[model samples]
Target: MAPEPEEKDGEFVSTGSVLRQVLFGLVVAFSTLMTGFTSAWPVVLPKLQENPRSFNVTDQDVAWLVSVQGIVGMCTSLLSGHMVEYFGPRKLLLINLFPTFGLWLLMAFTSFLSVLYLCRIGLCISTYIIKSFFQAYIAELCQAKIRGAIAALPELIISVGVLVIYILANFFSYEVVTALCAVPFLPLFFLAIFLPESPYWLMRRNRTDDVKASLQRLRGQRENVNNEVKVLTRTSKVQVSAWSQIHELRKRENILPILLVLSILSLREISGQTALFSYSVYMFRQAGVEMDAFLCTVLLGCVRVVTTIIAVPALDRAGRRPFLIGSSVICGTSQLVIGFTLLMEIPGASWVPLAGLLIYVAAFGLGQAGIPWILMGELLPTPVRSIGSSIITFTYCLLMFIVNYIFFWLLANIRLGGTLCLFAFANVILVIIAYFWLPETKGRSLENLEVAFVKRKRLDQNDHDSNHEVTIELPLS
Candidate 1:
């Protein structure tokens, strides 16, 4: 690795460290590309439903196939969160590759509906574990100054994966696509082996030398990482039982961050991105778009990738709060345009939904799709990071399953226009909450954030003591 980049006036002045971090992030983020493949695989399900190539399947079966990952994900997320805390991310990630490869192999060859359901469950385990841990891993790896940009890489790569799978599906059989998904794992395994473990995790286990060595590798061999090691020593000193960590959540300092992250993630689900991407083709057809729905879905993927590429780099510069608020506004407006255009039955407006979808995907890709996950790492304190993240991940998957399971019903009961308008209204709520309450995490170290909360708790206690003293001093009231 190159030497650590220089810091000038508190900003990174060279690309060497940032480049190294991004490279590591991208390699680890390849796991998330599998998430994209699984998410977009539903686009091909309708075609399979038309033919039932080798297995007998129904619309209900297809819905189960599409939504079952979320159920399995909820369970695995809790396990993986604990696993990440115990074994650390690097080992857990390497162990994850075995199941991921095996599941893809099964997917490539399976003909039975039961076996395919089993494969989806395995896929969810591999990918969602990565989803649950990688953000925490990357946040530990990179500095706060450039953390937002580096953390956002996974979202960008996921979009690219979606676009790639869409293009491949146009010309290849589902089996071929399934087989090809396994190929990336070979490189991922080799690349992941060389990446350093999280120094914070190392510190928690009393591996002081290993923590320094890991910090050296992450910061570059030429750099002196002693200061960083000292910070890790201070911040990661708490070693407690998992139940004790869970009890920590009852405190104001810990629970407030959990609430912040949970609210953000809940709002992310309510924004309908998961349901939108999962059912993009069906949604396009329902909107009466004259363009080919598959083609429009592919375009949506392309636009998502391009916009995320452009927008992610600006995240650290513009800060998370503004990016999220701006992205929410555009998303709401685009949904409204689509809803109005469809509901009014405007003549020659068959093209409107496609146009609106492109705009929505672009805006959603800009920040909404990525930032909440990034916050999962930034906001959660070390003492409760694992449990807090697990709880949030469980809720996220549950909401995802609910939204996906009920999406068609929502469209049937209220029409596409009304369903989209409901999603738009969600954005409105997100914007209001975010503007007033979301703290600016840009350029703030994770250690500093933890200390800030501790200080706030102290101040609150001091105020309470002062009030008690005043009550004692009063004669009669």
Candidate 2:
């Protein structure tokens, strides 16, 4: 489609203005910051558990606190996608932030646990919506050459947010930490009000002039963006209502990409990032590491931040499939060894789980954490991207909800080592799926990828036996 959008020397070529593109990406990254806040309770909870007025909570209660956000996020993610269609992406961000800003302010004025839960749920809605928003916005706006790097930016910022929470938790009490988290949302809320709406979305609405203006601003005045704008105009918009998105998946046009994305997204959760970091202190404590839990967690947070920074460039050149398979193997091994050690109660190597957890988090940051979302943005078409993303994101939260809700029970029933062993097995299976089924999206424009996959889907329908067509060939690097 579109003759593969001219590349230079076999590399993906991007033409957007650097300053405007980076600025837009930086501003939207705030969404991930709040999402990180939604999940950072573990780092702050060691102190919360000790405070008498903070309500008597057990390990199970803390787990519920981390998971209930997913419950709320799962319910609202699809609705947020439709809201993006009805009001546009910029407005969606503003609407999403209101509850978080208001709730956190109220929580600061009171120490009630119930209020804290309400605040967490409120931000989770924003968190999931923002998660959906970034995928849609970048899918619609980014140049192919930089897409992998740009897509990783939000997750990178999310790691930074977790790091900030960890650093703050080192000194602040529960109430003060909650208040500090709320402060950033104030500036972010105002920034969302002023950011440009997705240009592709405007094209769908047939707002020609606004589309041109947005393109000019995004691509720079002197640079030519007419061909790109015209390309966006030709893409289809979803005609079906949001409730009927499932029915769309049955069509030959939608089935393969949707299945591939759902598999990756679901596997991403089961990869254990949430189970490891959101509850890192608990897991580390179970390992019987002599080091203080908070200190160890802070180190984990720093590792997450550093490794994510390293992954941005890697995803672009090394491509998605290699990192997904390579990182999965490493993460699986670490989880398996850590699980074995803890299950056996190996004496004196309390360092085993911590060492494994560090490696797991680092490898996770390198690939599993960032690449799937990039592919999610790449594979889906503009026509149904909102609903497609909603379905994908809803599955993300729902799977994460299951992981968090059952995490402690899994620990209690199977013991720490056994729970980790389960994750390890799941990751091992993921590597096989990724190699045989996942496609390489590096060096391709969103339009080119959509056309090629759609073409392949049509061909499979005709041949019915071209099974070899299921997986793609990546560049031999």
Residues 1-477, candidate 2, lDDT per residue (tens digit)?
012222321322344486677677667766678877777745676677887474665777776676777888789876866877888887777877767767766755556778767766777777888788676687566666666778888889888887888788878997788778888887888876767777877887788788888877776788777766666666544343565555666664566676677887787688666878777878878779889987898888888889999998888888888898898999999999999898888788888988888998899889888888887788876666778888888898888888877888998999889999999888987887777766677766665555444543334343321122232332212
Q: Which ten-residue region of model 2 has the weakest summed lDDT? A: 1-10
Identify the leading candidate in terms of lDDT: 1
> Tens digit of lDDT per residue, candidate 1, span 281-352?
789999888888878877888899999998778988887878888999999999999998888889999988
Scored by Cα lDDT, where does model 2 land? 0.74
- Clash number for every model? 0, 0
Per-model TM-score on C-alpha atoms: 0.90, 0.87
- Candidate 2 wrongly placed segments (more than 4 Å): 1-16, 45-64, 111-114, 238-240, 243-247, 344-348, 455-477
Each prediction's Cα lDDT score? 0.79, 0.74
